[model samples]
Target: MQEFEPATDQLDEAWDAIQHVADLQDAWAAINPQGEQQRLDDQLDRNLVQDSDDEFAEMEVPELQSRQNIHQGDQPRCAIETCDPEITEEQAQHMMRQLNEKQRQVFNHVSKWCDDKARDQSVDPFQMFLTGGAGTGKSHVIKCIQYYAKKVFARMTESAEDMTVLSLAHLGTAAFNICGQTICSGLKINPKSQKEYKPLGEESLNTLRVKYRHLQLVIIDEISMVSTTQLTYIFGRLQQIKGTYTDFGNVSILAVGDFYQLPPISPPTPLCFPHDEILKDIWNPLFQIVELKEIMRQKDDAIFAQMLNRLRERKKKQPLQKTDKELLESRRVEENNLTAPPDALHLFYLNKDVDSHNERKLASLNTEMFTIKANDVDQRGGRIIQVHETPHRTTRADDTSLASYLKLAVDARVMLIANVDVSDGLCNGVPGIVKGIEFCNSQNMPIVVYVKFDSDRVGAKTRTTQFIPPHYAGCVPIKPRKESFKVRGRTFTTTREQMPLKLAWAVTVHKVQGQTTDQAVISMKGLRKSMAYVALSRVTHLEGMYLMDYDESRIFCNEDIEANVAKMPTCDLSKANPLTEIDHNTNFVIAHHNIQSLHRHIDDLKRTQK
Candidate 1:
């Protein structure tokens, strides 16, 4: 074959196309700092060039080269500086004023450390763990710190171009609650793999430095979900990225969570596991512990709150109390069809059950179904590929939160699968009802789905690009989200773009962790004691919780975790109760175990107790 020579016009066009791709990538990075899409796009461009005529092999475009050493002006701006909006100092101080005693104490300690660091970066950074039960304001304190940090950093940098505080959480919902990112994403970690993190080369280090130039404090929420191995990975990755050998590269840390809520997922030992030498070495010394004791959510029902607390830490020998059991039994739901509220979320133990329940509920809606297929691209070993969908099945993992195909209908109850807006309570696991679907102008694909959320305030104040129906003023418009993940048994990674929603007539207990629901229909089948507590606690009031197939057997706390938590140092909360002695001097009646001894006094006791 005659040697193929590229035409000058074609070469110039190709160069222009490459330049255009680079510009698009820069814009994409501004929105998505993870940069996975950009990397995949770059690989696709290279593969196309390689398959071109042989004469063009030797001609290389500089833009197509690796961006490791690109000029500073072209480097992506720090994610925090761009993604997060500014919080005025006045707003932060106002939040500080609203904190409870223990919350204010934690804030003062951490903010003081931040003040010291702002004055002198050479000082050793502060590390602390703030532990509390559900609804004790750990998340609220985190927000305050985040707002305060932004103001401090703005003052320090003088141009608001640098970020000094980073927020992370083990769960996406918790992360969004504080306007933060998941730990795996924030640290650039692979949750499935834990290869040793070696120091980066000069060029790579330079790039990392540019991205995290002024990161000083890290606030990690849902600390109980953080495992020993993951903790080590976090330290190692931060050390490497910061180019220092110090613990977490001398970055200050505030970890907040309760061990009694939920332990780490399997295959990874929890941070509270006593036998892990690595955890003991890294956690015990690196952080001071502060426990928040006030039960703010159930402030109106102190008796119920006390009962839940007793059950949360009940040991194997300390069986459930008769009074608590009777109270829970009173709220027991006899049947889903008869007693369960139409809007109450059914919390199940298994994913199969949740899916089946959701499907059944959706079919009951009797509306025209709408199917949305995910747009996916797979990358494996320097090759770009696609897993063709068969007539029956698609190539998505069964356990992944994201589905290959989402089926929805008008009036279908759905839950958000992604964090759209945290402050507005539009994060993952929030329930909503589909009102209408807006299709693309050119195609049948859905551009936005109108969802009237259970929380009316979710989209009330938020601005939207779509036209809202005057009658459905509270409906929020949800757009499709792009997610990147690897299948369990697959070698390739799949990047999918689809709507961030799931049929939410039913959901798993694990998904409801750290979320508060107004009403919940909880299934007690096959759930452990810890899981049962997590599910039950999601409902704010006892009257709002309806248990199906209630079993007291599934109500025991982890023995090891209980012991470890007992030994944890707690802040003296003597001042936490601001009430006077009269308010705190309520008398408690101890019930007699034996009827024989109390037989004579039974009549007297009944009159006095009543």
Candidate 2:
């Protein structure tokens, strides 16, 4: 090429032409879908799906994938994903046969409703609040409904694989007791913002509809713990998911709980405390109450049962009878002498006291102390922003009770914070003794902790592990729990990997709400009267219950709750004939009846028209 000097104007024109062409290409790329896709592909190839980890981004990681799987219906919401082999048809039938007359009536009513639902009969959804005291065979009825009614639904639907029923509770421990899942987990609710529940995405809704297409019944265990606002959210969410405007999407609900126990947490009032007239209207029509009487737990001791019943509704200012005072005083034990029953569970009103007792008990044990830390990852908008090598110590964050750090010894007592297996009684709040620790080959961190559970049922199956003592037959190997929790004063969420266990020398009254212990030494110091009732009711018999301080002053139920409960209807055996009665006020006639009565009721309606 010949080197030639061009004019200044010509050179400037050529440079501008090149710049214009470059700008045109940039604009085309900005609008081109293919170009945008290519950019995404490149970003995904480098495992960097986000431009910034701190900001919101589309995630393709396994963690996010797993969460999506749950939303997509590939995973179950309740702990009863796999049916327990022990809950057989024969066993369920046998239990039903043994039910009391009142329990039998509930079973019959629910079973008939499930049958009607399966048959696609045009009827209103079944809604009932099964209320009872501490022990009125409510749990027994729940078992019967779960094991027996499921068969009816499966058989009628002609699909054994179809999910027909779900059991849910407000609290994790309560749900565990029922072999179910927490309401938030089962309903895909964001526990942090329960009152402000938003509708699920289209994809999630579609998947849930498919998953629960055959679902006819839902059993809510701790109904008392469910707040009015949360209850509304549940109803709205169900309606949205089922694509129906009807109450609870026409799904049958058997809400079982004792309102006399622990009420809903503050900021949200109890179901009885309807905030508005609209809510009150919805509440009255939504649920038909069935108050269960007859205390089954203390049936052997009728006197004690009567005493508990009397005390259940006792007013705050009411004086305890001399006999009641004498009985309670007889079980009083000095606070300093709690160690006499070395194995008895000590119940405290505060977590701090529980922690103090556990720490002191752990320190008293003569063994090597192992400080195990959790692997916590702080994430915001689907991307992990930071990793906490030594996480801040917290007893609870969100739903995960697993602490950031756990201190243990070989013989230190521990309690499960999660339900390892409910049917085997290896549920939350279960006590055990540390047998041994198995460390990972790559790190000093413990991979599994062997625990000798108090109940033989927990570790009945022999586990062939080298880490546990060869002589020990009831050792269960507990692995690290992986859960996400919201950190305080932080915008991001933290995913923690730690053992689902905590010191068990002492436990809080809140933890033992729906549980029963063989023997317990309870401290009612500084606790509300409602809390005192819950703590006292945990022991089946008065002989097994020991009070640190018998403060009868703090032993009464809420007066308003009592009045509300009194208005609730009890099951009448004479009226158990199903569909025999109809509401005269509503535009639609509501009926409660079995198959035989359905036709007769329709005939009666025809006769009345004449």
Candidate 3:
């Protein structure tokens, strides 16, 4: 036991190793319960003190306890002076009391799901699929469930690590809102090409086992953006890592998103493909589906909400009423009013237009401009790849990855591309401007971009360590990682060291989903029908939108995926159906329905939300 006690930094490492062994034991027992103990005893030798040929339990905690200390750890790392602490469950409860009936029902269902998990130690976690359109409180419900899940697990488990849950999403912005990370980053799965993914490499398996063996739950936001191939890749990697054949390695998965939202960006996508391939692959026997019926985002504007419903349902585009239609159309017709709305983002369908708008704004401001070259060096400080580094697909500029050449100007509009500090309100998609800059005292090169996000000042680190892009045709480093600047507030620390800000004067509509603004003008060309609804929904009211022109094609989208997903067992809820009965005595926890009331309550929620 004395020999097993390692350095402080290595405590979790040792614990993780033990956890992996336990994972393997569980998997082996499931396979052959009669002889698993002996088989495990015979195969593992290094550091494993097992009875020669028959043993099921071991005394390992005393070794880790030989040197144990606990402190209040900040969840989201800040880049500056104070550590940003997570909201306590008590605080979350106070906020949750604000949810309407439909929102409350969703929370209650998730609470019971997790509560059942706490009561049963032998049963695997039950998977949950929460279906809702924008403003149905999908994101809000996710936070509430996360809060309650943590509360239940903390009470039931002795080991804090055992109660841990993984919160993940498909993209940085989506992940940021939920205080999570990109699925690609969390699963350590490469999204470069569907054909090139290899889940069973020795080092890869070892890495996955070490990182996720003890994790019991996963919550994925923006399931709409996740392709079937990506889902399969995640499930496959988890199975290999945990040595289990169960979907998600027998871990419970809670997926949240709108089925009719924008389809995935790549292949094997629109997960509801022919023959229900995606459902069969990742969501099946244990999967539960809950659909939210409320349109909380526009609760205050019922007529406008109805207009949106018509757009999504592809109803005959009827002429607007004399009052609202004239005001909205006049706003569109008066091109001058659309040109210079204060604090309005000029949305576009093409990158060229976005780039052109950014260039013009930069030129007009004529602020002091500075550029920082990324540091891509080896252990000895020698350049690794001198030319452009195209990170598989995840890190490429074309596919939402950071740019190789990032030009920054003081007073320029920018968005945080990563979760720099979650507790301090520094999240992905948070817009800000470079208030000032600091250069190397001697080198006279830009070192820190002093950014004012809303109000909090954050220093964006320009160089830090990060995951290296995987090469398809060449041998990659055995470790396969790189260095980039990261914001490490005094409270938390992370290995990621890359600058997290990107220019945001204008951006693609896809980049703006699930976000709202005071005013926005969209160029509807080149966008899908669903994309139009997503873009249109971002504006709170008709007065806030300035459409360059509307085309019939803009409101039509591919319906194959929607039709496929609809066939899955579903529980839809609205005021008419009422979610009241199911909250208490419903095993149909998989299907929940509660469309938010499209009343005046929305404006109140928005005021409190900001």
* C-alpha TM-scores of all predictions: 0.71, 0.74, 0.66
Q: Residue 340 of model 3: what lDDT?
A: 38
**Residue lDDT tens for model 1, 408-483:** 9998877676546555546555566788887877343488888876544456556364578886577888887765
Error of 3 at 559 (Å): 2.5
By TM-score, the better pick of 2 and 3 is: 2
In model 2, what is the error at residue 148, expressed in angstroms? 2.8
Whole-model lDDT, candidate 3? 0.55
Better of 1 and 2 by TM-score: 2
Error of 1 at 198 (Å): 4.9
Residue 328 C-alpha lDDT in model 1: 84
Q: Candidate 2 clashing pairs?
A: 578-592, 578-593, 579-592, 579-593
Model 1 accuracy (lDDT, Cα)? 0.64
* Rank list by lDDT: 2, 1, 3
Alpha carbon lDDT of each predicted model: 0.64, 0.65, 0.55
lDDT of 2 by residue, 1-610 (tens): 1356657678757855764455443455579856644543333233211111011111110000000011222221111112243576556656776677677778778776666666765656778889888878788889888986677777755567677788887654466567676665566654443444456655556767777887778899878777665677678768887888888988888899888887765333457654563333345556778878889978887877888887888899999888887888778787325343554677776667777877887888888888888888987546677887688564332435566778988888776766455445555555667878778773446888888765445545435424456665568888887766676655456888888787767766655666665577888787675777777777778887888866888788877887665565554433444433555555764455656756534643443331
Model 2 segments beyond 4 Å from truth? 1-86, 266-268, 277-282, 335-340, 375-390, 393-400, 418-430, 441-444, 452-476, 481-487, 490-497, 567-575, 578-610
